[model samples]
Every structure is written in structure tokens, then in C-alpha cells.
Target chain A: MKILVFVKQVPDTDDVKLDPKTGNLRRDGVKSMMNPMDANAIEAALQLREKHGGSVCVVTMGLPMATEVQKKALGMGCDEAYLLSDRPFGGADTLATSYTLAKAAEKIGGYDLLLFGRLATDGDTAQTGPAVAAQLGIPQISLASSIAVEDGWVYCDRDLGDTVQRVRAKLPAVVTVNGGINKPRYATPINIMRAQKKPRTTWTAADLGCDMTKIGTPGSPSSTKKVFEPEKRNTDTQYLTGSPEDMARALADLLENEHLL
Target chain B: MKSDYQGIWVFAEQENGKLHPTVLELLAKSKELQKHNGEKITAVLLGADVSALADTLFSYGADAVLLCENEALRSYSARPYQKALTQLSEKYRPSIILYGATPLGRDLAPRVMVSLDTGLTADAIDLGFDEDGVFYQTTPGYGGKILAHIVILERRPQMATVHAQICSPIEPIADASGELIVEKLNIEPDGDYEVLETRSAEKSGESLAEAKVVVAGGRGVKTEEDLAMLRELADLLGGQLASSRPLVDNGMLPHDRQIGQSGATVSPDLMLNIAISGSVQYQLGMQKAKCIVAINQSEDAPIYDIAHIGAVTDYKKLVPALIAKIKARKQ
Candidate 1:
């Protein structure tokens, strides 16, 4: 079993504070961390490799700094890591990003399984994995809670909010796993030292034979016309000034007046 | 005229022969957009033996319902459904396509976008035509602090998955009529993936969106044991228990109970912010709730800025008293 896992580096959402006046996030000096769900993906791939006896390789598409996440994955027991970084790959949307990743999948051939996180925290659009499956003309199962492989087929139990859909797909299919699928393991000091010796590769869009028109902003069909803060909801909050008991009673009366009681 | 692509289409998603509620909502929204573009509104439906849904779609103001029924689409495996939708779009060449940003929609729409080589904006909150007559999609991102208006720079059949409940479904007219175009797609059931079983959660697992009232806890909830107080209040109000994203991340609550940009966007009637400071992302998710009450120790918490009512005190002491008061009021 050969597994290719895609991961991403994102802003530490916990540290992302809002600018009260501008209504923009105070992104300056905010640190970056591995996307939580993608760490779960790496753990899933590592566990699969443990049982099936093959190599787990991690890949990401971002600026050169994204190598941080690749290094983390390597330290987590991946045999090797690949980063897709290029000047042209900048400003690519899900469509262009998926195309470039698909090209990477072609260049690094013969993967029996392709894994992705349910979504990237930054975009929160779980579109790339499925789009890549479509571009490659392969099957895809998304939001899997558990995955099992047997007899050249993969079975995944997907958690779709109120329902669970148990599905099975053949080998070489794309599967995007949700968070809480498994707890990711931390890298040990010895493994961290050894991971520095592991093979790491960086490929540009041209190196992947990407269509210059389809690999970056030029290939992206969607363009951001404007980015601005959403208007705050129009409501003047009335503070309840009283003792705890009185405040509770007043709130109850308010609810009653609103026909909520 | 933009390569002759014409009209607007909404994907009427269905499960177990029942049309998803979001489809009607999208139809209502498309009707509003139709006024600006002066184009017909079409509801594109793909399911097995779902032809009866066409009347309902029309009643909700769809100018037409493109009904494509096939057994291969019965289970909604991405392999067949994406192909079927892509074929219909290629054949009809609609100017814009809309879908509810549902799990299935998120799964299906992007594949079709790839097949047709188009753009798709996910979870758009608003749609409109600019002065130049160009359509744009407004979606919140970057932790829900910013809204980006996006346009398909050069693509026919622009696509997007809209957030649910952003607009209410228009009133249905019993005698409203529209054109019904019936077609059968030619596609075999995908042999690659097969659905084995499907099961819904127990009734106790109430969805936050459907609840009339939501009692949400955040970092101020203290410990996991403190959740019982909020759950008690929710039960008293005949509602569901919800949590800020941090609670779920802390394993204090399940992911489905999380209410935020990364989780489920809820618009309940009354939502109590128990110790939640309300990040921009959290506010964006629950801002649509009819009434909001922010309760926390700090008076400067941002949650109070939008809440209808606020109390600057510890929720630990306030929640129990409020629950008792509500119970007394009901009596």
C-alpha cells in the first residue's frame, strides 16, 4: 500500500485576534501551525503503512515556508516529503491548486491511495480533493470517520452530520478524512533528529509540466473582486443591571413577553 | 453575450425521495436574483423517481424544473452524480448554477466544476448583479472576519454553493405553474464505489439549526462537568445544546455541536452566549439568530456588541438562577 497524504500550514486560529476598529483579524506576528485535520490525515496514513507495510509520503502546496509542515510530517514517520512551491502557483484557487497537485500525483506515480484533510482551515472549502479526483477521473469518498482496507477495496464510514454513510471504493481512490478520526502522535527527539536526514523534494509548476495558463492566477476562473469586513448586526444590547436573582427574574419576564416561555 | 450561456439553475438536492429544504430556499433566492438579470429561473433536479418534486419546485417560484431521473443517481455516490450534473450543464449551458452548501453539495459541485472546467464559490452568503451587470458571490472567510466578492473571470455556467438560511423560502402559490423539462441521463451505476448502509442519528441528537432556542457555552463554561447546567437550560427551553469552536477542540463537546464558520452555521430563534466572548467567526455563525443574550464576566467582551441583551457576571452563578426562573415562569 502506497499512500500519498496532502497537508497544509495555516494560521493558528486560536491566536488569530480580531481588530476591533477595522473588524479585520490581527494576523501580524500570528504563528503558523499544521492544519489540525491534516495532522489527523498523516496519522491515518502512518497507521495504514504500519499494517500494510508500505511507505507514507506527505505533500503540500504553498510558499517555501510550507516545508515546515512537511518536516513535521517527516518527523511523524513519513518516509519522505514533497513541497509544490513556485512563483506561478501563487494566488491559485482550489481549481488551479488541484490541477497542479494532480500533476504531482502523475509525476510521482503508482499511489494506491490518496488522502486529504476534510478541509483547509484558511479556505474552509473541502473542494480540492474531490476536484482532483474528477480531473484524474477517479472515485472519491469524503468526510470518512473510519477507513478499512481489504481485498483491494477500501471501506469508509462517513460522518455527514446527522447520518452515517458506509461506503466502499476500489483501490487508488481519493478519501478525505474528518477530524477526530485518530489522535496524531508527536515526534520523538530521536525521530526528529533522523527526519532531518530524510529525503525532501521541492517541485515547481513547470517541473510538474503544468499548463502555464492553468497553474496559477491565470488558470483560476474565480477572481476576488473585493475583500472587506461584513457589516455588524444592527442591535443595541441593553445591559441587565441588577442582582443575580433580579437579573434572572427580569430575563425570564423578557422571555415570557417574547412568547418564548 | 458571454458566449450564449443563458438562465440561472439551482440544484434541487434530495434524499430518500424527499427534497432538501435548502433547495426551496435557493429557489426563493434565485427568484430575487431573476429580477436583476431578467432571465428565467430553473431548478435542476437529479434523483430516482423524484419527478413529483417538480411541482413543489415550481410552487416555490422556479420558472422551470429540469427533472433528470435515473437509478444510478439514487445513492449519490460522487462518481455518477457529478457526471450526471456535468452532462446536464454541458447540454443546457445555463449562465449561473447554485447549490446549497451541504455535505453532498460540497462533494458533488466541485467535481462537476472540474469536469466543465469552471469556477465554484463555496458557502456564498449573498449574490447580486453589479452596475456593470456582472454577477458576483459574497462569501465570508479568513475566520469569518472578511467577506470576499468573487466573480468567474472567464467561464460559462458560473457555480456556487450557498449557505443555508441566508434567505427565507418565498411563499408558495398553490396554482403557480412553470415549464417542466423531463430527461433521463445515460450513466451506469459506478462500480468503483458502493453504498452499503445509511443511518440517521437518534432523535436525541437534535440539530442546532432546527432548535428554536440554543444554549451555547464557551471557554467560560469552566469544566466539562459545568456543561450540565447549560444542557439543563436548553432542555428547559425545549432546545438544543451548542458550543463554541474551542469547546469542541477541547473535547468538551462533539464536533456536530460546534457552532461557527468551521462548524455548523445556526440561526435559531434565541441563542444564549454563556461565557462566550464571540469571535468574529462565532458571531458570523450565530448572528442570524433572532435574539441573542451575551453573558460573561467581562463587560468588554465583543459578544455584547451584537447581543440583544447582556449580563456582565459569571455564568456559573447566573445560569442556574436563570434556569430556575424560566422553570418558575413556565409553571
Candidate 2:
């Protein structure tokens, strides 16, 4: 079996700093890591490969630096890595991104299964995976908290609000794994060392057979018109001190006067 | 790329034959949208025995209701809901469709959009429209790093899912008038998907989403012992306990207990923040809290700027005192 996992490099959310003037994420000098959810996707694929005796291919489309993410995935036990990086792929929204990924997945070929994180940390749209599946015209099982593969079929326990459902779909289907799907294993020293030597196949838009006009920024229908910090609430600071009883009385008094009690 | 789609439809989400809170909220918001755009709030209720709620929907703001009740639609297993919703959208050709952004909506809405080959904006925080019937939808993105403006042009029934608690429901207009249109889909239920059984987890006090008072903890709480005090204060005040991502990452709390972009967005009436320094990620979640109360030793804590009430004292000291105060007031 050949399983494909899609991943992306996102600015380490903790270290992400907005330029005070521009109110946009400061990308330069900001550290990037594979999206945490995508890491779970890679781990899920790696685990399946371990069980099913298959090769796991990690694929991504981003800037050249995103190749580092592919290396990281390879270190984590993926067999092959590919980076479909090109200037044309920049500024793609979920639709364009999914379309580009679909084309790239076709280019890589020979995939029994497609796995994706429920959503990317950077975008959080959760649209790309299902969109890709739709564009590929394949059955998709999303929000899969747990999955089992047997006899060329994927059976999944999907998390639906306060309920779980058992879902079954044939192979060559796309599955988006939620975070609870599995605990990602840490890469050992040997794996990390071997990963450094793994070659990352680089593909441009042309290699993926993507139309330049419909591959990236221009292809995306929705755009971020503007980015601004949410308005901070203007409030007066009132402090209450003393014993719990006293503080409680004061709070109750405040609440009563404010008509909230 | 403009497509001809007409009417405004709300998916009247129901479970066990009762409407969900989000359905009412959507109807209320849609009522506002209807008045502004000269459109009507049409609701699509899909499930077994769902027509019973059509009267309630009309009271809440539905101008006309589409009832698709079937035994197969009983439990909401995505495939059937997607099929039903897609069929309704195709038949009515609603210019806009609103969903609650609940787990079911999040799962089913996108699939319907995909099946219909249309565009959908998920987890919309707010919705507005222009005179030309173009819907302007807003949603938090990049883990709440930014609010992205989404417009589904060239697609019929510009779809959006509104996050719960962001919008308040209006009291149904007394004796308000609307038409109740019951339409059933002709498709048979595919038993390929089955709900073997359903069980609901017991929810804790005041779901953070609906809680009027919320107390959130962070890494500054130091240890599990500190969380005891935070929990005590939350209990005394009749609120739910929330936390920053760091605490959840550290295994101090579950993901459901985290309050941030990734977890649950809250708009509590009163938010009691303990030992949490405000990051934009955290702030974006609780920014809508009516009155924010912060207890942190740092006078320079970012939380203080957004808090309506704050104490520049150790949370260790503050938590105990607050708990005691509540206890005494009760006595």
C-alpha cells in the first residue's frame, strides 16, 4: 500500500508576533514547524504503514523552506518526501490550496490512501482536506478520531458532537484525522540522523501539471481583504480585597448595584 | 462568477425532535439579515418527526419552513444530512444558508457545499449583506490570529456557519406571521451509515460557551494545587473553569477546558481570569466576555488592559480570599 500524507509549515504559533505597525504576522526570522495537526496526520500514516507494510509519502506545497517540514516528517518515519514549491502556489486559499494539492497528489501517483489533518493550525479553515477529496472525486471520511484499515477498506470512528459514529469507506479515499486520533511518537536519534540524508523531491507548478492561471493566488476565489487586531474592551479596573466572605459580599454588592446579581 | 440563488435558509438543527439553541440564534440573526436585505428567513428542518418544530421556527423568525422528516434522518449521521440539505438547497436555490457551526453543522455543511459545488465560509463570527444580495461573512482564522472576510461569490445560497454565543436570540415576535412549507426529499436513506447507539457525556457546570461567569487558569497557576483554588472560586461564583492552551498542553486540563482560538470561544457575562497573561490568542477567545476580571501579580499583565476589574496581587492570595468571601457571603 502507498499512503500519502499532506502537511504544511506554519509559523510556530507561540512565537508568532504581529508587527505592531502592520498588524500582520512577522514571517521573517520567525521559526516555522510542521502544523501540529498535520504532524498527527503524518503519525497516523506512519502507524498505518507500520501495520499494513506500506510506504508513507509526505507531500506539501509551500516555499522552499517548507522542504524542512518534509525532512522532519521523513525523520518521523515517512518513507518518501516531496515538496511542490513554486512562486505560483503562494497566496492560495483553501480552495486553491486543495486544488493544487489534488494536482500534486495525482502527479505523485500510486496512492492507496490519502490522509490529512482535520485542519491546519495556521489557516484553521478545515476545508482543504474535504475540498481536495471533492475535487479528486473520492469518498472522504473527515474528523476521524480513530481509524482501522483492513482488506483495502478504512473503518473509522468519527467524532460528532457528543457522539461517535463508525464509518467505512473503500481504499483510495481521503481521511482527515483529528488530534485525538493518536499520540505522535517522538523521532529517535537514529531516525533523525537518517532523515538528514533523505532526499526531498522538489516539484514546481509545471511538474504537478497545474495550470499556472488556476494554481495559486489568482486561482483563489476568497482573499484576506484586511487583517487587524480585534478591538480590546475598554473597561474600568475595580479591585476587591480581604477575606473570602468580605470579598464575596463586596462582589455581591457590585453585582447587585450593576443589576447582574 | 455570480450565480443566481434566492431566499435565505436556516438549517433548523434538531435532536430527538427538539430544536437546538443555535437554531434559534441563527433564526434571530437571520431575522436581522432579512429586514436589511428584504429577504425572508426560510428554515430547513431535516430529521424524523422534525415538522413539529416548524411553528417554533416561525415564531423565532422563519418566514417559511422546509420540513424533511424521515426515519433515516433520525440520528444525524452526516451522509443523510448532507444529502437532504443539498437537495433542499438545490430545490429552493436559497441565496444564503445559515448553520449553527455546531459539531454537526461543521461536519455536514461543508459536505453539502462540496456536493453542490458551491462555496462555504465556516465558523462565521458575524454576517451581513449588501443591497445586491452579496453576503459578507466574517470568521476568525490563523488560530484567531486574524478575522478573515469571506464572500461566496458565484455560488448559490452563500453559506455560513455562525459560532454559538456570538449572537443573541431575539424573543419570538408575538403573533408574528410566516408561512410553514413542509417539503420532503424523495431519496431513500442509505443504511450504509448507521448509528449503532448514542450516548452523551455529562457536561460540567455552565458550559463555557453559555456561562455568564468564566474563570480561566494558565501556566501561572504553578501547580495542580493552584488549580484547586481556581476551581473553588469558579464553583463559588457559579461559573465554568477555562484555561489557556499551555495548561492543556501540560496535561493540566483537557482540550475542552481550554479557552483560545483552537478550543472554545466564550462570551461570558463575567470572566474571572486567574494567573493568565493575555496573549492575542487567549484574548481573541474571551474578548467578548462582558466584564473581565483578572487576578495576576503583574500590574503590567496584558490582561489588565482588557479586564474590567483586576487585582495586582498574587493569585495564590487572591483565589483563597475570593473563595472565602463567597463562602462568607453565602453564610
Candidate 3:
């Protein structure tokens, strides 16, 4: 029942905007935190470890600052944490990221399950978990609301478009849990202090023996260099005032003229 | 990496004998791709008893339909569907494959991409080739701020899951026909996963993205009663009722009616936004509306920046009055 939860650090708010000059996220007033859904993944892993009597580990792939997420996971009861960080890992897309993670999983050795948040807040692709499972050549159950393990099998209640399916897969499977999975527990002050002493390690692409051609920008087949300004609708709104009725009348007139009435 | 894969494909997604709506849209887009590279258009369908769907696929512009049927694929357990599609892909060697950016597509396509050892762009909004004749997968990414035209320079069978409503579906021809290639694998290996039980879930509010008129509310919409008032206006205007994510999370409205990055992408003729301050996520799903009318208590709400008509007043008073005025005009 050793569970590995993969989390990511994302901008704290959904209101994040890109800097027009740099074509990158504007980090002036924003803070980075563990992606909200990943907390549920960590919670699911910690709960499973509590029941099955094994250690829960958390892993994240990003810059060195991504250890913030690892520490947060540790404070929330994860037993071990690792950061997959290095220069070569920069500019990796979901494919390269999943490949690097698969290599890390192989390097870590011996885990019954791999868990992920349903999606990263910033990326929003929700493709990495299934890709990692495919990379590992293992079974995967995604969009899970609940997950349970028994006798070397992992069962999950998965959310599909028109049905909720209760599915079970063998050990060494991957599961991506949706935000509705569970209410993540808050970290206690004592646990936060204890987390400082937890066994932590940082692995680079070289240390993971990652194929240099497949670890970063070179490994990522699809590339996006076309950054453009989002289309803006002119906002010269003609304010209709006087009274509610007057405003409504003006609006109705506008709609009628626009052939929308 | 680019040796000899020849066909352009659209995944013909169906359930219980009915085609997913986005399938038609994907086929329409794939036809545009076919014209670009001189490839034959294909509709690759997978199901237990979906042979009859080939006719619909042909009518909607598929030059051929690759139907892969197996009992294991009757329900979409990721492994078996992934295996079947992957096997068929290797055998057929399509040069370009497109899927609808749906939950099912999102679940299945990536695994197949990994198995095929190719790159896939998720939720692409457009597709085209550059001056160099290289394919570009266009999507709104980086929190919807930048429109990225991504390129897969070296992969065969370049793949992407296209956003719904990104393209207009081609007009279907009557009694159209195409080459129907039925593939039944010799061994439909069982997956490690088992489906023990299933119960029906909800889809987004009946094509909210395709509505001609959309009346959307947000956090200012407090309760079901308030929603009902908005619903009244929607019904009067012959449109659909939509809400920003807050109402959906509060359980007052189902996920189908939610409008934002995490939910459906809505493009309507007229979008009447009431009380929603509009987060980046919410605005991205919309912003395609031909007309927007914003009414909020605060004059400084960001939604007003893009709204064609603005009312810096309480929605309660403004909405009720607007409804009354519309009724009078109709009479």
C-alpha cells in the first residue's frame, strides 16, 4: 500500500493573468501554492497509508521552489518527499513531464500506486496522469471521486460524462482524483515543525538517468511559440441611468435595435 | 518520425448507439486538414454494436470510416479502449488524428499517444499548416492569455483533442457512403481494471455552448430562488440559463450549466451577465458572445470592461425591470 502522490505548485488564484511583455505569468502579487486538487490526491494517499500501514510519499516536478508543495504534503502527513528539479527539466510540456516522472518512478522503485490531482490549475490539460500510466505501461483510472485498495487491488469511483462507474485495477496502477474526492485535512502547527525534519531529496534529470533528448524542450515534440494578445471587445458601454425602469427601457431599445429582442 | 503515415482521422465517439455531438465538428475540421495535406479523411469508430453509425459518419464528410468493434470496448474502460485504438492506429498508420476535447477523449487519447510514442496537443481551438507546410495545433493556453499555435515538427499521426464548437459542422449529405473498414482484433485482452457498477451522471446544461442567447449569473446569484428568477428571463428570451462556477459549486446548478475554464466553452448570440465579477476562467469560456450585457452592484467589476451594455446598479431591481420592459415590448 505504498502510495506516491504527484502534486504541482500553481498560482494561488484563478485570476492569474499573463504579462504581455514576457508572455509569462505575472507573479507580482501572486503566491504559488500546491495545486488545490493535488491536496485531495495527497489526502487520498495519506488515508490509504493509514489503513494499509505503509508510508505515503509525495513528488513534484518543477523549480527548486517547488519544495514548498513537498513540505506542505509532508506537513499534511506524508512520510517522504522528493523534488524533481534541474536546469534541463525547463520548458518541458506534459509529455516530457510525464516521461521524466515515469523515469523517477522507476528510479524510486517499489510503489503500489501512483496518484495525481485531476488537473493542474494553471495547465488545465489533465493529460499527465494517464500519460504517465501509459509511460509506465500500467492500468489507470481517472476522474475518481473515491479510491480504496484491497488485497493488492485499487478500486475507484470514476466520474464520466453520463455515469459514475466503480472500477478496480491491479496494484501499480495510476489514479487521478477529482476535487470532490475528499476534504483535505489542514496541517497542524506541530506537524508543520515535524515536516522540517522529514527525509527529503532532490533529483535531477542526470541523477534519474533520463534520456537527455527526452527530458526537456528537446523531448517535447509539440512546441508553442505563438503567443498573442487575447482579443478585446471594445468596452464603451453606454450607461443607462435615471431609474430601473428607464434603464430597462433603454436596454430593451438597444436589444430591439440589435435584432435580439 | 514522419515516415509514411497517410490518413487524416476523427474519432467517431458514440454511446448507446448515438454519436457524440462533437464528432461531427471534428470531422468537419479534419476535412479542412485533409484538403491541406491531400490525405483521405477517416472516421475511426470504436464500440460493440456501432456499425450503423458508419452511415452518419459518411454523410458528414468522412471519406472512410474505420469501425473497431469489440465487447471490451462497449464501455470505455481506459485500458481496453486504449489498447484497441492503439493497435488499430499502428496497423492503419494515420498521419493526423483528431478527437473531441471531451471527458472521454481526454481520458483515452493520451494513453494512445503514449503507446504510439507520439505527441498530442489537448483541447486545441484551431488547426492549420504554416508556410513551411508544418501542422500547427492552435489553442488558448497559459491561463487563456496567449493563443498558442503549437507545432509537432517530427511526429507522425499528429494528434489533438479539439474544443467543442471550434468549427462549424459540414452539411450532411443524404444516403452518403464511404469505405467502411471493420476491424475486429484477434485478441481483445482483458484489462486489469473491472467496472463493478455504474449510475447515470449529468452532462452540461443541454448545449449551453451552442445557445443563441445565454443568461449567466455568478456569486451574486445566492439561492435557487434567485436562479429561478434568472431562469424566468431565460425562458422568456428563449435562451439557456448559465452561471459562473460559484453557483455550480454551491450545487444550485448542475455542472452542465456552469460556464468557465473548468466547464463548458460558451459562445452565444447574446450573453446577459448578471452580478458575475468574471474571473479569467469564466471570461475565457465566454468572450465569444456577439453581445454582452452586464449588470452588477459595483461599477468597478471587471466584467464591465468587455460588456457592450452596462448597468452599475443592483441586479435585483435592474433584472426585474428589464424583464417587465421586455414583456411590454412583446405585447
TM-score: which candidate is best? Answer: 1
Instruction: Please write out the lDDT profile of model 1 over residues B153-211, one tens digit for every residue.
Output: 67988999988777889989898889999887898999988989998733345777777
Instruction: TM-score for candidate 1, please give it.
Output: 0.88
Q: Worst lDDT window (10 residues) for model 2 chain A?
A: A224-233
Q: Order the candidates by lDDT, highest first.
A: 1, 3, 2
Q: After superposition, how far is residue B140 of candidate 2 from its true place, in Å?
A: 2.5
Model 3, residue B42: distance off in Å is 0.9
Scoring only chain A, what TM-score does candidate 1 earn? 0.88
Q: In model 2, how large is the Cα lDDT of residue B35?
A: 80
Better of 1 and 2 by TM-score: 1
lDDT of 1 at B296: 88
lDDT of each residue in A42-158, candidate 2, tens digit only: 888888888889799889888888877877898898888899888888887666777788898888888888998887766666777877776776667787777878887788877
**Model 1: residues with Cα > 4 Å off, grouped in runs:** A14-26, A188-190, A240-261, B202-213, B218-240, B245-252, B260-270, B275-291, B296-302, B311-331
- How does each model score on lDDT? 0.85, 0.75, 0.83
DockQ of each: 0.56, 0.33, 0.48
Question: Which candidate's lDDT is highest?
Answer: 1
Clashes of each: 0, 6, 3
- Candidate ranking under TM-score, highest first, comes to 1, 3, 2
* Model 2: lDDT of residue B285: 80
Clashing pairs in 1: none
